[model samples]
Structures are given as structure tokens and as C-alpha cells.
Target: MVQIKSSKYLDFLSQFGVGGAHPGGLSLTMEVLKNESIDETSHVLDVGCGTGQTAAYLTSRYDAKVTGIDIHPIMVEKAKKRMKKDQLPVEILQSSIENVPLQDAQFDLVLSESVLSFANASVALKEIYRLLKSGGRFIAIEMTINRPLDKTEETDLQQFYEFQSLLTEKDWIHLFEQTGFQHIHIHPQPSQQQDNAVLEDYHFSESIEPETFEVMEQHFEKVLKYQGILDYRIFTCTKG
Candidate 1:
């Protein structure tokens, strides 16, 4: 495999046209949305929306007005194409979570699946808070460290995943509080050992860049190495 030197770990998944690039994937996303009271009048924002899978689902399932955003131009284009192909009325934009160009307090729901950890958590959370209407829900499924990582472990994770912080559950809660979120609830997910299966079943696009495979290899190695220490959690918070 050709070696790639990109620090943005998500670029690899994007290049391969991977949809639902998160723990539990689209199945978990569907399960979580089943509990949400979305309707045609509801406005939802999907942050770091890879290929617009969740956005399309929300639009088709709930008939909700959905907006999907990703920092990567390629991802945005792919998401737009996905919505177009599915005849979904979702808007796709290329933007960063820390600096979204949308109006403040406009969305009734903001969804982030495996997204916040890759960003400066504090700033990104504050932005999420700003974008949400009062009483709006911010739902995130993200990677969290089960215990404090040692220096070497931290370096490896940070370098491989481009993680801003491998925060523990408590650390995540504290940041949510500081960012003015209320009614916070966290549910830890059991680790499912299926990295190899996921890779094996991945539907690689014919146009996939060679560098993506190298990054995917690095991602797989780190995930296997840190399987014992890494965990994922779903957090639901309300904007006060």
C-alpha cells in the first residue's frame, strides 16, 4: 500500500465513499432516531455528515428539513449527490463545526456521530450550543477513553486519528456543562469487535484514492491496539 501523510484521519473514509463511518454505523443511527420525535416541521443539522446517509434517512423517514455539513469538499459533493440521487430534500454544505456559517439557534436537532472528538471539543461544543434552538437536542455518538491514556498511547491515538482529545466520560460531561448544555445524559456502548469484518465488507468506490488504503490500514492498527482502552458513548443534551 502507498503511504499517506494526511493528519485528517477522516479523509481516508471519505475518499473511499464510506457511509456511516462511526461506531455501530447506520444501524445505531436508525435505532437512536427511532426515539426522537421528529416531524415535517422539525429542522435538523447533521455535522460531519459523511455521504449524507443519516441526513437522507432523516428526510425520508421523518420528512424533516435536514442540513448536512462536512469540512471536506469531497464529502460535501458526495453528500449532495447522495441526496440528489435519493430525491431527498437535504441541503449539503462544506463547513467546519467550529465555524459553521448558519444562523444561530435555528435547528431543532443537531446530530454528531463520531465527530466531536476529532474537533477542538470545547469550541465545537460551543458552536453546537449556538446553532441549537432553546430546548433543542444535541445527540452525539463519539469515541471516549475508558481510562486516562499514558503519554505513548495518547500520542499514538492523536497522531493516527487526529483526535483533539481522547476524553473520558467525565471529561465529556464537564465540557458539555461548560458549553452551556443542560439535561445531559450519557449511555456507554459495549465495544463490538468487528474492525476486520467492517473492512472486509467495505464497499470501496472505484475512484478511491490509493492513499486512502494506507490511512485505513493505520486506522485499523490503532483501533486493534487500543481496543481495550477505547470505548464509545452516546450523549444526548439539551440547549438551555
Candidate 2:
């Protein structure tokens, strides 16, 4: 596990009223699910549902029943608060992606956003496969490496993103197939305007050190080279 040094890494969402994950949480989520024509009739399982952004949106926008799970207690608690604030009936739990506290085939859909890379991807895939109902849709926007990089390039990953063992597009497809997912659809995203002032404020002076800045730039460049490694990729799969 990568060292989670700052509890405030994502605290900007609550502090500054940003949508947090994926910036435009609800719209982005809907766009990702729209391909599958998901609606109020679906039951969603959100792996690593950070602050309940996607969960709240799913329930409110589509009237879907959503269950959100995360490994961090603080994140889970914040998600619960967000659900209550939005008047959504979302179930949030502090649990790992490898060992979710759910039964088999309980969900009509599964969603993950920029979270799976932190876990052992294979185990996470297996867990997602087990929890999803037959024909259930698994939709996600994840962080991934476009291709294998040299040690120097790999070392450019920031402390927070270091835990992410991003696999290539081929690896992603293989993992999905190996986990018993069928009819996989992958949509690659392109880089867009970046307004990282919030994150910059959080890091303050540390954000400008030459070495640190180089690493950060390299990270973004790598992501850009592969269409914003974490910013791109929407996948839909069916449980077999």
C-alpha cells in the first residue's frame, strides 16, 4: 500500500465545495453509464466510493439504489454525510476492494472511479465479478498507464499516486476477461483543461521544487501521452 500521508489530500471537496472525483461528478458518471442506458431500475455497487459523490448522483439522478464501499474510515464517513446531505439512501461502508462485505450477485451494476488502481487490480476485478448479478453492468473511469515505462519514468509518479500500479490497455482487457467479464467496452478519454489550483494550494511551496515539479510534470505528461492516464478510460463489462 502506498503511504497515505495527508488526510487532506481530497479534503478540498468538502472545504471548497468542489465535486471532488472527476470534477463534474454526476454528469461524468451519467455519461459513462448512458452508453449502457442505465436508469432508475438499476442497483449500483460503487467500489471505493469516495465521499459518495458518484453514489449520491446515481441515486438522485437515476433513482438507482447504490451501495458504496471504501477502505478508509474517514472517506466512508464523509460519504455517509454527503448522502445524508443530499437526502439519498446510499449505504456506505469502510471495506477493501479485495474483500467487500457483500453477497454474490447482489448488484445490477458496479461502478468505480479513479480508485481501482490503488488495490491489487486482479483481486478487485474478481471481487467485482463475484458481487455483480448476471448481466449486471460494470462501469468505471480509472487511472492507467498507456504503456510500460522505464524506471525513471515510473519513478515520476507522485507520492499519492505511487500506489497505483497502472496497467496498459491490453492488461486491462486481459484482466477483465480473466475475471469473467464479457462484452467489455472501453472508451478512452483525452486531456482537457486542467485547473489544479486547489491541489496546488494544498501542496503549497512543496509544489514548486524543481525535482518535485519535474516529477509532477512527468506524471501529467505521461497521462497526456496516454490521454490523461487517470483522467481517461471508461469501461463497461457484463458479468459472465
Candidate 3:
């Protein structure tokens, strides 16, 4: 089993239990889901599902059979706790996207929100492909660099987020195609920072590390430093 080394930045997000920590946050998630062909009978998988916010929403909104998996222990625990409190019948597991412990062709939809870049995208994408039924959809909201970055620029962002590689829109499509995903589509996202910053909810852990505070501060700093270069894209494709 491949494990994601816990970086301070990732640890901070997990410890804080920040739902919608992805670029567009949960509102974007709702918008994306609205366009999908989901029903109560559909089986959905949320890879790198931090804290189960989206998983819970899937059950509440579409009444879908949802399962969420994350590599971080804290995230898995919090996600489980969330389901227990909400009384939602969502299964939360601690696992890696590269090698998920689930049967193939089980899910109608699989989602990765700001997640694939943090792990081996090729391996994870292949795994996602195996998990989805033929004609099922796979949605990803991931960071996409508009242009190639200078080594210094790339290193700064990569080191901070611990991403595998800074992928562009084209690079991502190539990956999808390589994984046999057909009917690839890039959905335009409404700028989350257009008028107001996306509203974020936090469930703070009991024990907070001082360094974790620095992680959040540095996160905001990187967001400012990178700006347009650190943008994200919503890619939706079908398995065929």
C-alpha cells in the first residue's frame, strides 16, 4: 500500500477538518453534482474524501450509496465521526487512491477534489478507471498550471503542497486518455474569488499543533504568491 507522506500543510487541513479544502470548495461540488446523472441507486466513491462533508451531502441530497476514502488517519476518523453524528449510512475508509481496496466496476461515479496531484496521478487514475463501471463518469477538480513554471516557482508550490507534478490542462487530458477515459470534457468553473471568497467551514480538532497554524498561514501566502498560475480546472470524463 502506497502512503502519502503527511506534509504539514496537509496535516493542518486534516486537523482543522476543513471541508471543501479544494480550490472551488463545496459549493462548486454541489454545482458539479447537479449536472451528473445520479440517482438513489447510484454508487459513488469520493477519493481522498476529507472529513466526509461531500459524502454526507451525497446521501442527504441524492440518497446515493456513497463511500469515502482518505489516506490520512485523522481525516478517516473525522469522516467516520461525521457519519455517525449525521446518521448517514456512508462508509468511510482509510486507503490510498493508487490502490483502493474495493471491487472493480462497482461505482457509477468517482470524484477527486484537489486530490490526484498529491498522489501518483497515473496509478491513481488507472485505479479510478478500474473502479468505475463502463460509461460511468469520473470527475476531478484539480490544480492546473496555465503555463510551464520556472524550476524555482514549481519547487516552491510543489514543496508546499507536496504535489507529484504541476499538470496543465493538456497534460491532464493526456492522462485521462492514457487511462482510457472517453468523452473527456472540461467544465468551466465560475471564479470562486470573483465577488466573495467561498465560504469555508471548519471543525477544529481538540489538540492543535503550533506548526499547523503556520501551515495555514503559509497556505494563504502561497495562494497570494501564485495567484492565476495556481489555478484549477474541473475535468469530467466517461469510462468506456
Best by the TM-score measure? 3
- Each model's Cα RMSD: 4.2, 5.7, 1.7
Backbone clash pairs for candidate 3 read: none
Judging by lDDT against the true structure, name the best candidate: 3
* Poorest 10 consecutive residues by lDDT, candidate 2: 199-208
Global lDDT of each model?
0.83, 0.69, 0.90
Q: Regarding TM-score, does 1 or 2 come out ahead?
A: 1
CA shift of 98, model 3, Å: 0.5
Per-residue lDDT over 82-138 for candidate 2, one digit per residue giving the tens place of the 0 to 100 score: 778777899988888888878999998898887777678899899999999888888
Compute the lDDT of residue 177 as modeled in candidate 3. 99
* Per-model TM-score versus the true fold: 0.90, 0.76, 0.95
Clashes of 2: 1
